[model samples]
Target: MPGWLEVVIRSFVSLVILFTVSKIFIRKSFTQVTYFEFVCGIVIGAILALGSINLQIPIAYPIMGLLIWGFIPYFMGWLSIKSETFRNLAYGRGIPIIKDGKVLEDNMKQQRYSSDELLKQLRSKNVFQVADVEFAVLETSGDISVLLKKDYQPVTPKDMGIKVAPIKEPETVIMDGKILDEPLATIGKNRQWLEMELEKIGVAIENVYLGQVDSYGQLTVDLFDDKLKVPSPQQLPLLLANIKKCQADLEAFALQTNNPTAKAMYEKNADEMMVVLEKVEPYLKQ
Candidate 1:
C-alpha cells in the first residue's frame, strides 16, 4: 500500500478505537473531570496520533496503550464508587475555604490556594465581598460554591410568607414560523385556539419566529421581524382588572344600599372576591 493510503487507513482505525474507548468511560464536562482522567485523556490522544502517522510502529501497540489507559481509570472509578477511602484518594473531598463570613487561612494554605486566587474564584460566583459570604467550599473539580449571609441573600416569596403557584416548563408551539401540533396538544391547546390568540394580537402565524405557551395558558410570541412590535397577551391582566372592578363595585353597592340584608350580602361577596384575587394575583401578574 502507498504511504498516504496506509496513513488514511491507520487514522480511520484510530478514530474508531478512540471513540469506543471514550464511550466506555464516565461522561463528565471538561471542568468536572478529575486530574487523573485529564492526564489519561492527553496520553490516549498522543497514542492515537502516534499510531495514525508513524507507519514504522505497529498499530497494535497504540491500541494496547489506549486500552490500558482507558480500562485502568474505568476500574478505578468503579472501585471509587464502592469504597469511600478510594474515592477520596481518587477525587479529593471538598474543603471549606470560608466559614461564618471569615476565610480560613489554614485550609487555604493546605490547598495551596492563594488569597488572590480565592478572591478571583469568589468574584466568579458574583460575590465581591468576602464578608457577605456565609460559607464557601472548594470542590474537587476546582469550582467554588458560595452561600451568602441571610441578610445579604435575596428575599424569596417564601421569605415574605407569600404563596405562589408552581411554574411548569413552557411548551414550544411554534418554531421558525411553523406550527408544531404535538407541543400544542401537550399544552392542552389546538391549532384553532393558537390561530385565535395570534388573531387577537394581530400577528399572523407565519410572522412568528418562535412561540411558547406557558403553564398559565398565555401564548408569548417572538416575531421574525425584530422591527415589528407585537402586543403582549393581555388575557390574564384584563381578567384580573375586571375582577378588581367587580370587587370595587360590590363594595360601592354595599355602601350605597340602605337595606341591611342587601348591604351584608354585598360586603360578604366583596370579601370573598378579595380572597380569590389574592390567590390568583401571582399567576396573573406574571
Candidate 2:
C-alpha cells in the first residue's frame, strides 16, 4: 500500500471511530471539562492514528488528530447533561467565598483568586466594599453570586407596605440631548408635549440628562449634573439615628412570624442594617 494512500485511509477511519466513540462515551456526564480529559484526547487521537496508518510520528496524522481533539469536549458536554455526577466531576462543586458578610480568605487562596479580583467582582454588583455582602458563592463556572447586605439593596414596594406592581419598561423620551421622537410617539406624545413638561420642571431640553415615561405615563426627569453631597458633620448624628431607627423597625417586623415572606423580608433587612452600620463607621463612635 502506498504511504500517501495509507495516510488518507487512516485519517478517514480515525475520524469515523473518534466521532463514534465521542458520541457514545464522552457526551453523557460532563458539563465542564477538566485538565486531565484534554490531555487524554491528544493521546487517544495519536494511538488511533498510529494503529490505523502505522504512522511513525503524530505529525503525519494531523487532520484526524485535530478532529478528535475537538470532539472530546463536545461529546463530554452531551454526557454531562444526563448525569449530575459527571457534571460535578468535570466542574468542581460551588464553594463559599463569603459567609455572613465576611471574606473567606482560605477559600480565596484555594480558588487562586486574588483579593483584588474578588473586590472587582463585588464592585460590578454595585457593592463598593466587602462589608455589604451577606453570602457569596463561587460557582463551578468560576462566576460568583452575591447576596447584598439588606439595607444597601433598593427598597421593594412591599418593604414600605406599598402594593407590588408588575415591572414595566420605561420609554425614553429624550437621550443624548436629542428628543426620541419615535419613542415619544409610541407613548402617545410629541416633541411639543415634552418641551412643555421640561419647562414645568424649570429645565430646558438641552439641560435634561434623561427623561422617561413609565407605564403609568408619568414622566421621570433626571438631570446630568445631579450630585448628592455627603451630609455635613452636624447632620451625621441625625442620619445615624434615622438608620438605627430603621434597623429596629426591621427587627420588629422580622419578629412577626405570622407572615413567612414578611419575616424573611425583615430578617434580610436586619442583615442589611448591619451593613449600613459598617458604612457609617465615623458616625458609630460619635
Candidate 3:
C-alpha cells in the first residue's frame, strides 16, 4: 500500500473509533463540563491524531489507550452518580467567590482569578457592582454563576400584584409569494393596506420574504434579498451633556476634599472626556 493511502485509511478508522467511544462515554451538559472532562477530551483526541499520522506507533496501542481512557471516565461517571462523596471528589463543588457582598479575596487568590476578571464577569451578567451580588460561585468549569440579593433582582409585575398589558404576538402578513389573509384579518388589515406599507419601503408584496404586523399595528417587512446596513442613532449631544455634568461633580468633590490624587484624577478624566467628545462630533455630522 502507498504511504499516503495508509495515512488516509488510518485517519478514517481513527475518527470512526474516536466518535464511537465519545458517544458511549460523553454525556454533554451545558451547565458545567468540568475541567477534567475537557482535558480528557483533548488528550484523547491528541492520542488518536498521533496514532493516525505516526507510522512508528502501532495502531493497536492507540486503540487500547482510547478504550482505557474512555472506560475511566465512564466508570467515574457511574461512581459519581451513585456516591455523593465520590461525586464531589471527581468534580469539585462550586466555590464561593463572593458572600454577603464581600469579595472572597483569599479564595480568588487560590483560584488565580483576578479582581478585575471577576468584575468583568459580573458586568457581563449586567451586574455593575459587588454590592449587588448576594452569592457568586465559581464552577469547576471556570464559569462564574451569580445570585443577586432579592432587593437587587428585577421585580416582576406579579410581585407587586399589578396586571401588565397583554402580550401581543406578531402575525405574519406576507411570506414568500403568498399573502396571509387570516392573520391580516385578525389584525384588522387587508392586502391593499399591506401593499401600501410595503411600497413606502420600496419593496413589493411578491418580493417580501417575511412580513409581520404586531398588536400595536407596527409593520415590519423584509425583502427576499435586502442586506442594507442601518445606521445607528446619533447620541453626541446626550453623551456630551452627561460627561460634562459628571466632570463638574467630580471636580467639586475633589476640591472639597483637597486630595491631590483625587484632583489630578478628576482633571485627567475630564480632559479625556473632552478629547473623546471632539473626536465623535465629526462622525455624528456624517
Q: What local distance difference test score does each model get? A: 0.92, 0.73, 0.79
Query: What digit string (tens of lDDT, one per residue) describes model 1 on residues 1-286?
Result: 8999989998998888888877877577788888999999999989988998999999899889988998878888899999999999888899999999999999999999999999999888788999999999999988899999999999999999987878999999999999999999887899999999999999999989999998889999999999999888888889989999999999999999999999999999999999999988887785
Instruction: Tell me which of candidates 1 and 3 scores higher on lDDT.
Output: 1
Off by over 4 Å in 2: 1-63, 161-286
Which has the better TM-score: candidate 2, or candidate 3? 3
Residue lDDT tens for model 3, 81-198: 9999999998878889999999999999999999889999999999999998999998877779999999999999789875444557999978885899999999899988888776
Query: Per-residue lDDT tens digits of candidate 2, residues 80-143?
Result: 7788899788766888999888999999999898888898888888888788888999886566
User: Model 1, stretches more than 4 Å misplaced?
Assistant: 20-24
Query: Least lDDT summed over 10 consecutive residues: which range in candidate 3?
Result: 228-237
List of clashing residue pairs for candidate 3: none
| Model 3 TM-score on a 0 to 1 scale | 0.56
Model 2 RMSD, rounded to 1 decimal: 16.9
Candidate 2, pairs of clashing residues: 27-75, 27-78, 27-79, 28-79, 28-80, 29-79, 29-80, 30-80, 150-272, 151-272
| Model 1 lDDT at residue 106 | 98
Error of 1 at 182 (Å): 2.7
Off by over 4 Å in 3: 29-31, 162-286
lDDT of 1: 0.92
